[model samples]
Target chain A: MKFAVIVFPGSNCDIDMYHAIKDELGEEVEYVWHTETDLSQFDGVLIPGGFSYGDYLRCGAMANQSNIMAEVKKAAAAGKPVLGVCNGFQILTEAGLLPGALLRNRDLKFMCRTVQLKVENNNTLFTNHYEEGQVINIPIAHGEGNYYCDEETLAKLQANNQIVFTYSGDNPNGSLEDIAGIVNEQGNVLGMMPHPERAVDELVGGADGLELFKSIVKQWRENHVNN
Target chain B: MKKVKIYVTLRESILDPQGSAVKGSLTQIGYEEVQDLRIGKYLELTIGDTDRDIDTIVKEMCEKVLTNVVIEDYRFEIEEAN
Candidate 1:
């Protein structure tokens, strides 16, 4: 399956995501610039982490207005799968592809370390490979990873099973309900504050992240073949 | 020929840890009775010779670009430049 990784100015994790997809999963991956207006050539899009636009104004705020967001929105609306990691998650939320906003860490510090994430729901296309409530270690590095939503919206999200990941031990950024990751209502778009791409290989630390991409690619192929 | 003033703030429902921290310091300095405190962004824009719908544009900017509407609220006023 062909995967397109979106690259924006100040995006440092695109290469890491690319390598994780190609070198680890043996999947065909291509880099797409944030200025590109067309995404008709790929089956999936990955918005990797990093300080896009140097986190100016707000994290992912500037990157969301990039020329490519229009096409990304169309792709997402058409049921195309999109995965956003770290700053990418911020961009997605800013772009309105996902709900909730990432706020500054309560400690007002940039947190960088491996944290345990409990998979909240596995029915989505992104987490089918893992059982619900399973804990996995992934590195999270961000100064604004705190997720916030109103009580009503939080209840709706929980009832809909849109929440995908929650912190296992201590809540790192004071995120509501310890939400580390979530998916859109359609379950095709996911935005998580952690960097799974950074932990997809044992050499780097662990290979827990490899299967996420593999599962998506496998699902993409299955759907295409069925069609 | 009108001027607009915009005030953006985190919604009251959400916690303003930053603002709270500052208020705590105020209390530590022997100042009590500070009931409420919050932090927000303030923006001033000048539009004198443009026909564009500045309000619509500004609101769109706030929702899609400027303030993250999920956690923040924004309001603006247009007035004659003093």
Candidate 2:
């Protein structure tokens, strides 16, 4: 399946996401500028990490106002798999595609390191390849990765089995309940702070993240190739 | 012309790490009486005269871009431009 990596002005990880899909995953992927209003061509959308709009006014706040975000919402509504990492996750929350807001890290510092993430729910397409309650190493780099939502929203998330990943060891960013990643109610859209694309090559670190992309492709093929 | 002052702060329920750090620094500096601290954003906008109502425009701007209602609470005041 083909994918589109949304490229905002300050996005630094767009190339990494493209390389992960094109070189590692061996899938069709292209860099789509934020100004482009149409996203109907791609099967999935990946919002890569970076300080979009310099993270001004708040992380991912300004980027959410861009013209392309409206199209991204449309793509999500059409049942397309949308994966957002780091600043991309912030954008998803800001755009109301996913619940909760990513606040400044509890330590008020920019954290950059690889951390262990536990797969909380493997039923969704994004985490289907991951074994339930398995731990995988993934790198996270951000100044504002603390995720917060009201207790009611948290209850809803838990009830729907939307909490996909949680910090395995120590909570890197002090996200509520050690939440490292989550999917929307429909389970098609996922927002996570960890850099999965950065972990696709074993030469660099580990190939644990590659399965996420593979899972998406595998689910898409199962749903589309036969029908 | 009109001048609009906007203040944006995290909601009471959300934790403000920056504010907490500042408070810690204050404590280190021997300011023991300080009870709480909250860090927020302040923006001043100078708008030219327009047909639209100033209050309406400012409120719309705050809701749309100046603040995120999900985690932030925003308030604004308007004054005649100097």
Candidate 3:
């Protein structure tokens, strides 16, 4: 399946995401500029991590106002698998595609390190390849990765089984409930702060992140090709 | 002409780590009476005369891009431009 890595100005991790998909996953990938409006051609959407719009005003605020975000929303509405990592996760929350807001880290510091993540729900299309309650190592780098939502929204997420991943050991950013990642109610859109794309190679660290991309492709193939 | 001053702050329910850190520094400097502090954004906009209502325009701007209503609360005041 073809994947489109949305690129906004100041996005540093775009290349990493592209390499992960093209070189590691062996999938067709393209860098779609933030100005582009049409996203109908891509099967999956990946919003890479970076300081989009220089994190002005707030992280992901200005980037969410970009023209491509409307098309990203359209892609999500069409049930396309949308994976947002780091600043991409912030953009998704800012755009209201995913619930909650990523606030400044509780320690008020930019954290950069690999952390353990537990698969909270493996039934969704994004985490199906991960064993239930398995821990995987993924790198996270961000200043505003603290996720927050109201108790009511948290209840809804819990009820829908949308909390996909949680910090396994220590919460790096002090996200509410140690939430590392989450999917939307439909289970098609996922927003996570960890850099999974950065973990796709055993040479760099581990290949745990490949399962996420593979799961998306496998699910897409099952729904499209097998049907 | 108008001078619009907008203040954006994290909602009280949300934790403000920056604010907390600042408070910690204050305490370290011997300001024991400081009860609490919340860090926020302040923006001043100078707008030329326009046909649209300035209040409506400022409000719209705050809702659209100036502030994120999900986790932030924004308030603005308009003053005569000098």
Candidate 4:
């Protein structure tokens, strides 16, 4: 399956995302600029972490307005797998593809470290490879990773099993209910703070994130290739 | 023309850590009377004469981009400009 790594101005993690898909996952991938309007050719879209638009106005706020986001939305509506990490996660929320907003860290610090994440729901396309209730280690690096939503949305997320991952030991950025990651109602779009792309290779420490990419391919294969 | 001043701040339900840190520093410097502080953003926009109504224009901009209504609230004041 081919993946498109969306690149916005000031985005620094595009290389890591490309490496993860091209080298680690061994999937055909290309870097798509933020101005590009077509995403129909890609099977899955990956929005990587970085200070897009220098985190100006707000994290991911400016990047969300790029012309390509409209295409991203259409791709998402078509049930294509769309994955966003870190600032990419923020962009997803800003674009309204995902609910909730990311706030500043409760401690007012930009934290960068590997943390434990519990697989709260593995039935989704993003976490299918993860066993239900399993704990996985992934690195989270961000200043505004505290995810917030109103009580009603929270209730809906809980009811629909959209809460895919949560902090295991300690809530890193004080995200509500330790929400490390979440998927949209449709279940094909996922946004998370952890840089799974950064951990796709074992040589760099751990390869626990490889399964996430594999899961996307597996789901697509099951639907298109196998069927 | 009109000059619009906009202020954006996190909603009351959301915690403001940077704001609290500044408040803590003020107290540490003997300003114990300082009760609370919340950090926010200030924006200024100059609107030229247009077919669109000013109120609707500012409201749309704030709702769509200037502020994230999900976590923050925004208020604007407009001044007629030369």
Q: Return the top candidate by DockQ.
A: 4
In model 4 chain A, which range of ten residues has the least summed lDDT? A218-227
- Model 1, global lDDT: 0.89
Against the true structure, candidate 3 reaches a TM-score of 0.97
**What ranking of all candidate models by DockQ puts the best one first?**
4, 3, 2, 1
Q: For residues B33-69, what per-residue lDDT tens digits would candidate 4 score against the true structure?
A: 9998988989999999899899998999999999999
Question: Any residue pairs clashing in model 1, and if so which?
Answer: none
Per-residue alpha-carbon lDDT of model 2 for A1-227, expressed as tens digits? 99999999899999999999999989999999999999999999999999999998888889999999999999999999999999999999999999999988888889999999999999999988999999999999998999999999999999999999999979988899999999999999999999999999999989899999999999999999975
Candidate 4 chain B lowest-lDDT run of ten: B12-21
lDDT score, candidate 3: 0.94
Candidate 1's C-alpha runs over 4 A off are B1-3, B52-57
Per-residue CA lDDT of model 4 for A1-227, tens digit only, reads: 99999999998889999998888878899999999989999988999899999999999999999999999999999999999999999999999999999988988889999999999999988888999999999998999999999999999999999999999989988999999899999999999999988888778889888889989988898998853
Report the candidate with higher DockQ, 1 versus 4.
Answer: 4
- Place model 4 in a CAPRI quality band: high
Error of 1 at A24 (Å): 0.5
Which candidate would rank higher by lDDT, 1 or 4? Answer: 4
Q: Summarize candidate 3's per-residue lDDT along B33-77 as a digit string, tens digits.
A: 999999898999999989999999999999988998989999999
What are the lDDT scores of the predictions, listed in order? 0.89, 0.94, 0.94, 0.93
